[model samples]
Target chain A: MRLIADLFLVVGAAFTLFGAIGLIRMPDVYNRIQAGTKAVTLGSLCLLIGIALLYPAWWSKLLVIGVLILITNPLGSSTIARALLKAGVKPWSKASVSQPGEADR
Target chain B: MTLTLLEIVALGLLGAAVLLSLLRLILGPTAPDRVVAADTLAVITTSGLVIIAALLGSPLYLDVALIYGTLAFVGVVAIARTIEGNG
Candidate 1:
């Protein structure tokens, strides 16, 4: 049982690491936001769940945390995206992808 | 033991999903893409919070997660409206 719990922890850590990587590796602001939000959300969830699983007695609380993550992740991303759009940020075009959009535009 | 394996797999899958979403973020051409990315991130965060709460044996964390989720959602809506209104 303890071994199993450890596995969850490892898995959670992997998720979080990837998420952080995605945040940096992805291209523009929009993409970055996507990477950051999705990766971090999942990563955090895994970490939390692993902790819960390791301590099965706290199943109820863990359940609550899971629900919260499911709800909030997308909401934050949308807010950020909307703010960017309002500021007049444009989307990537085929041409823009090959070369950074700002230079081409 | 089996349950542990399943949880690991779930985490892996969720991680992959986050990556897929990241692709959208990278390729997304507009501000909305990024906004969408952020939104997606918020969802993932909420999920993670619940998972940890269960693992750690604590219910108190749930309330904080719930509040955060609600606030984040409201924030997204507000940002969306602000963008549309300006446009």
Candidate 2:
């Protein structure tokens, strides 16, 4: 049980770290948000599960926390993305970047 | 008391991740970028709280984590709305 919990913690942290890296590396706001949402949600879930396994008595609370996270993470990310789009933020246009003359500049 | 190997490693990794997100929040180009970074920071903080709870063997911290999660979501939505310029 201890070993399993430790494994989950390590994996969750690694996922979270990668997610942060994606945030820094992504070209635009939308891509960064997408990276943040996907990684953080799953990372939190794993951490919660690890905690639940480590302390059996905390299963009920952990379950509720996990469910709340499962619901809210996506809602917030999507809402921000929608608001960005509505506010005139455009996704990166690869075509413009792909033009050799534009790239030269 | 000395920290366990697992605790040190976990805390180090989580801390690094949180710092990276904070860097984004600081240097992010646009308002939406900062919003995304802040949202991500809220989440990482929640999980980091849980990790602390586990390390200390305190269930009360779990409640705090729960409340923080709820607030973080609300804050994110509110920021998004504000960015949209809607009351």
Candidate 3:
């Protein structure tokens, strides 16, 4: 049981590590948000499940925490991205990802 | 209780990842980038708190994690609203 819990924790942490790396490596603010939000959200879920498995008594509390995270993380990220776009932060363009719009233009 | 091998590895990984996100928070090019990194860090902290609760064999830590998760969302929303209104 402990081993399983540890495995989940480690895997969750690994995903977080990857997300952080992507946050740094990706070009532009929007790309960073894209890389960071999804990985961290999933990683947190794995961690919550691992903790719940390790401490069965805490399952109910962990469930609440997990649900809150599931709801909030993406909502927050999208809000930030939308605010950024509204504020005129441009996405990385043909110089990086090669947009079809740029090709057409 | 003392740390076990797997917990140590897990903690190491999480700690490293937290540091990585902090690096972005420091170096992010724009306000939104910083906000995004901060949001990621907050979620990861909640996850770390859960792992800590397991390591400590205490449910109290879990409650703290839950509270922190809720507050983190509020914080994000407030920041986003402010940025949208001002920036």
Candidate 4:
């Protein structure tokens, strides 16, 4: 049981770290929001579960945290994305980029 | 005792998820993108903290995790409203 708990903690931390890296690497706002919403939400929930396992006494608290995370993380990301869209931030037209043509310049 | 295979696998999966999140955060192009990434990271942190506490057999950490998660949500909402109102 302790081993399982440890596994969860280490794994959860890795997920959080990965999310942070994504935050630093994604090419556009929408992509970042998508990545953040998916990866971090799952990662956090896993981590919390791991923690709960470690301290069975506080399993209730861990559950509360998990539920709160489930409710809020995606909602917040979506809200921000909506605001960004309203602000007229267009999505990336293509996966890659190119310089403006002389005709435009 | 040596780490079990199950533990290793769980850690690896969690790491993969974190890496994915990191990629999003780094490559995000706009302010709102970063904000979303931050919010996501906050949730991840809350979860990681709870797990760490559990691994250490510390019940007190669970309370912190609970409070942190709730507060992070509130923060996200406030930020979202601020951005929307400004725009």
User: What DockQ results do all the predictions give, each relative to the true complex?
Assistant: 0.22, 0.66, 0.79, 0.43
Q: Per-residue lDDT of B1-87 in model 4, one digit per residue for the tens?
A: 344677666656655655555555675555676577668767766765664664566677777877888888888888888888877
Tens-place lDDT per residue, model 1, B1-87, is 234666666666666656766665676656565556656555565655565555464666667667767776887777687777777
Candidate 3 residue-wise lDDT, B4-59, digit = tens: 78878878888889999999999966777788889999999898888777777877
Model 2 spans with C-alpha error above 4 angstroms: A96-105, B1-6
- Per prediction, the TM-score for chain B is 0.81, 0.86, 0.89, 0.81
Instruction: For residue A27, give model 2's deviation from the true position in Å.
Output: 0.6
Q: Quick one: ranking by DockQ, best first?
A: 3, 2, 4, 1
Better-scoring candidate (TM-score), 1 or 3: 3
Evaluated on chain B only, candidate 2 has a TM-score of 0.86
RMSD for all candidates, in order, please.
Answer: 7.8, 4.1, 2.5, 5.9
Off by over 4 Å in 4: A95-105, B1-30
Model 1: lDDT of residue B57? 49
Estimate every model's Cα lDDT from 0 to 1: 0.63, 0.85, 0.84, 0.68
Error of 2 at B53 (Å): 1.3
Each candidate structure's count of clashing pairs: 44, 0, 0, 33
| Residue lDDT tens for model 4, A36-102 | 6776777777677775675576767667777888888888888887776666666765534553531
Question: Order the candidates by lDDT, highest first — what do you get?
Answer: 2, 3, 4, 1
Candidate 3: deviation at residue A54, Å?
Answer: 1.1
lDDT, candidate 4, residue B57? 60
